[model samples]
Target chain A: MMPDHTIPPSNIASSAARTVFFVSDGTGITAETFGHSVLTQFELRFRQIRLPFIDSIDKAHDAARKINEAYTNDGKRPIVFSTLVKHDLSSIIRQSNGMHMDLIKTFVDPLEQELGVKSTHTIGRSHNVVDSEEYKNRIEAINFSLAHDDGQSHKSLSTADVILVGVSRSGKTPTSLYLAMQYGLKTANYPLIPEDFERGKLPSALPLFKSKIFGLSITAERLSEIRNERMPGSKYASIANCRYEVNEAELMMRREGIRWLSSTAKSIEEIATTILQEIKS
Target chain B: MMPDHTIPPSNIASSAARTVFFVSDGTGITAETFGHSVLTQFELRFRQIRLPFIDSIDKAHDAARKINEAYTNDGKRPIVFSTLVKHDLSSIIRQSNGMHMDLIKTFVDPLEQELGVKSTHTIGRSHNVVDSEEYKNRIEAINFSLAHDDGQSHKSLSTADVILVGVSRSGKTPTSLYLAMQYGLKTANYPLIPEDFERGKLPSALPLFKSKIFGLSITAERLSEIRNERMPGSKYASIANCRYEVNEAELMMRREGIRWLSSTAKSIEEIATTILQEIKS
Candidate 1:
């Protein structure tokens, strides 16, 4: 008998290909981050594709139509990786005969069985976060062993391989932690308080680390979205304060010759990868 | 002109044609995370293999020997995907007749060119973090945000999609925020204080959110490693204290039938992904 010298693959089954629709109800950037990372992990060993995020159910239908057409033409039963809102597009996917990666359903299954409660799945952001179980990482980071000093001016700038400086709500912390996790970097970030911009100088400790310092700035509106959670109903929540802080911070960063990127529209993954490009460039 | 009938090939090369090495200095997992993700993105395009990790030059030499042998056998230039201490592996890789993805070098290239300072690429964790602009995210999580309110009994768990209960340094906040970012979940986490565990009960608000309650526990050593940074030369840093805290937390988690995981040996990615699995499950 011939020895069946088949290459045993990882858990990812290529034949029973898994289609994960990493849909975002909005721009799909968040969906892309989680969805893409997971996809990247399995794509090499599996058949995987991503849908360019569509904003509405109609657009999702159109995309699904194209996908259905493609598989029909190929005479192959390709899995539909739609990151669409499951409720909005479930019927369409079911009828299309394409195996749709309904993350919501996958998430809801174990939750309902173990917990004995059917998830409304309508809890908006809170419900969505809970559904995906993404809270552990944040909780972990809050408690993760961090070798960072946000308040001490990051005095060891000379020893710093890279330093990040950004205004409040610029998506600095998550990005830094990501770089640290992905690239194993000892990332230290300094927040550009209004006083620093008003004084129009880089944090004093940053000069020596100037070569390694990278600035993070976000659009006032985006910053507001992130900050309103913390300081609701304050001048800080006012678009005016946000705008001033953003504009002043950018000018200060420019004056200090600190290279920076806008964290406004970019996902954390994109921000981290872009910074990696800078590090690798 | 020929009609563009072909799909852009999923990957540039085939797996059997490439000699891939998952290399790192400390643990092999960190290197594998980046190496595997990037490689996976290509869709099985290259002929690949992994060399777990090489600590000593002798191991490097032995691994190089096998890689060269494979290259000779395949009659193709192998690509070595590597992450290692800069001081150790350059010569070894250069000695090999193939392409090598030098993650550290890839990470350092942009820094040297832009900053006008040749990166030593020799710093500790700082080297990995600071070389890239990923510091912004890490800093923001620390430099900004609300205060930790562990003792508040009537805390606003009502708004939380999920509540994380654990001891200090058990990774609650980052996980919570990550859940919110990735899945749009509103996560609230509360640490399991000694008093709560002593009573053999979880936190007050946790039972209400039993379906979404999660726990994170770390090993005594890693917990101490993290605690030492905050309050060095104290009982908090002592292994004994770490053991006590861990034992108590684990006991309470089991007694209460609360789902929990060990954060000691896992990377942030592993931990985060695991939590996502549990919650989704």
Candidate 2:
């Protein structure tokens, strides 16, 4: 028999689980992302905390105090993944009773040597909306995506950088939004319904932007499972219906010469990356 | 006179702008993000490219070929920021004509030392949807945010982790989506309109979720600029109307004892982080 691994909240302090902190002078998102990736390599549980916007010396001291408190409470040194840009703030954080991993400085020093230039040592420059033009484009792309979600409108169909077509619950909407949010690409998605299958043609409006169209298909079983969660005990959630829909969608895509991929085992990030490579190439 | 500084596309080959590649076995988002942060510290122009899903040896060889081709064409070594996990793939890429930056292994070695455990060296684990429960929650959050955007529906209001109340164009939709996408927080946003202000109370539906609400206020000038882009020369876009809306929204929030912040000069990440801190605390 397998051993039960669940620990009660009261006994969590003595467990092997470690407390991890992602500390930064900005949103701390970069630190969290890189740290999370690195942590995933281990088979350990982490009670994660984020301390963002620690730009001032006083805030640094407070963050250090929190780290110290965590260390004292855990009876083990906490690991801190820090992306603090300023030297003084990092120095203050380093004084805490923690194993401080200086994420930014470690890479920055080597990069400075390679590039033969001094780093700006600037704070909060990575994700700030300082480039107004780029920021405006991103917001515009988001609005464009929202306005065009699920074939909501055909008014701006001509303006989309890419258009996605798929049956319902085949992962179109999320991919559209991610493409827009991450790459600033104006994306519109249309549902490939029974009506389109019956007509044996692409949606009338989609033909105009055929070159910008991509299709997403999924396994029938996966589609049925997803649909059953949303609408149980209905034909829309039946395995047979899902099979029909997926088959029809794939046939239509093939007939129209539209490139397509299956989203059954892929994340939205993977789907969006593949679509970007295809459309941009 | 100031220098023009603009290089034509035809002359880009001879210019100092170097080509940079983000190569990874997964989505390559972490590589791009960390590399971008590192590059932002330097004052240089880079033509960025993303090579995602390079998990196999053949793909690694192809990526290296591309890097070498870029080096030959540009007469300089292209900078490659790589997050490849397999040592063989990394070695192949390391042999390319680019200055390869092993983003993952560099940190992974130190992490193994700190944690006293060997890494799994998994490929495509960072952004893949292997954790089914977490992935489902994220997708649910996205759907919840979409269903509740701009106060579209009142169903499941109680399920929201946070509700944002703001005047139009004060940056609600993007923040809600970001919160949902990044943190799996089910967020709903309601617009604080003139109707609510005229009534001298919170929206009838909002008061029920007041404890979960956060307000966003923006500068009148900025609101006007954003509105003008949407609907030019209209009463809605006028500065006076914007000032009235901003003032009334602030008054309503203050009267209702709702926590609020200005979204005028902040990114969605910053706004979301601030809200997370306030609510999670």
Candidate 3:
């Protein structure tokens, strides 16, 4: 089969089309995520493939055969990003006709040297070892965020580590989930509905958790765009309504002395980490 | 300040306590996530500090000073996991009294050699570059997942890339969200309410999108435990109710020719990737 050269050529050199593989004994997410980060530095594009849960010898052999096939068909050595933890499996993958970049084996030597110990050489432990206390905390945090989403429940507000208050479509749900998932922090987000804005004060449900409340605000243009996607041509999606709600929400947060930040031009990671830092401070 | 040695020393050496820092020009999440994956190979404890948004010279200097302080306080060189893209900022970090593992600078030269192209060497480009068309798709996916969560809306069911169904608290919401966040796939998740179980069949709304439907099931005990946390001692949390719901949901999915998997022992990453593979196949 001919290689795919349909990707628009740019400033980067594209002498040959190459395939990249993310192979792991577990979810392959860490390998794929970090490999993508490193690959972003280079301008060349790749046909990315993910092969996860290569825990058995048979699976490892199957992955090797696939990688070898790509190498021969593409007329170039494919790049393999791997996190196979077992030594035998790593050896099997290393024998493939590809540039095997094994993150686990590459770092294990130096870590053992630095820590003065032998590595466990265990597969899937890092990804699936969720029976510990830390993992349980993460699950509990996830449950908290889901229950408190959109102010669905308020019975457990006192248990919340942080409560996010924002106008509708201001990027509250994703931010809340990210914070809980990454930092194991129980986050609850409440939307500022027309009733709250009409009251000209912080919502009555918020006073009990005043110290734990943080606010999220967004640009009127962006808010209107998001709302319009859901309910086009409605009053809620109008630019004038978005602006009015945004202004009133910001004023309410300021009057209540609740810290607020704009979600405009920011990724969920950026928003979550900023909130985590503020909460720590 | 005294070093923290409260961590139980096992096979690994504990000559001195060390502080690990995840430094980045943007959110520091990619750096932290990948660094933690690498660090898991060893059995040592670390005090992790994240210093993000170090985009300027002043912030880099601040981060260097913090790393230097940690080195002196801990009486050992701290381990720094950095994705600093700019040469000048990275040089500042290198000058600190720490072991700086620069993912960008270390791999860029080798990749340039392999690809025969110079890297962009741009700061904060890897994680924060989201203005492209790909990013717009991610936002659309997130919005779709939110709208369809808990079967809130079936208006856009036809547009979904994957529709997930499960009993309440069977790990549908987070899996759907993760699939959207990572893969830019429009995912919709529905909960099998009591009424649906009574009907003894898949929901009528699901049959039209039968090809896109995936079912998630969990152990009855686990489901009961999860539900009990929210509505303790209620019928919804009763072990008998949970067992009945899970059995009915599984049978309904099987009878409808829908693929189903258990979330009892799998992480969200694992579940999402498995479903992605099935969909692709």
Best by DockQ: 3
Arrange candidates by lDDT, highest first: which order? 2, 3, 1
For DockQ, candidate 2 versus 3, the one ahead is 3
Q: Order the candidates by DockQ, highest first — what do you get?
A: 3, 2, 1
User: Pairs clashing in candidate 2?
Assistant: none
Model 1 C-alpha lDDT per residue in residues A1-281, reported as the tens digit of each score = 11111212234333443333433333333333433322332212333333443545796677667667756665555444333434666556556646544444533344345324344433123223322222333333333313453544444445455677887768766666665544445567778888887677877777776777788898788688667867887888778999998899888888878789987655565576566546645
What's model 2's overall lDDT? Answer: 0.85
Per-residue lDDT of candidate 2, residues A125-189 (tens digit): 63346335566677888899999999999987888988999999999998988888877788999
Comparing 1 and 2 by lDDT, which wins?
2
Each model's lDDT? 0.55, 0.85, 0.81
Give me the overall lDDT of model 3. Answer: 0.81
- Candidate with more favorable, higher TM-score: 1 or 3: 3
lDDT of 1 by residue, B79-116 (tens): 56565655566568658866665655543443234323
Evaluated at residue B209, the lDDT of candidate 1 is: 70
- In model 2, which runs have C-alpha deviations exceeding 4 angstroms? A1-14, A126-131, B1-15, B126-131
Which residue ranges in model 1 land beyond 4 Å of their true spot?
A1-159, A220-234, A237-240, B1-155, B169-187, B197-207, B218-234, B237-240
The Cα RMSD of model 1 versus the native structure comes to: 18.5
TM-score of each: 0.50, 0.93, 0.90
Q: How many Å off is the CA of A145 in candidate 3?
A: 1.9
* Tens-place lDDT digits, model 3, residues B114-189: 6677878777653444455566676778778878888888886888999999999998988888888777788988
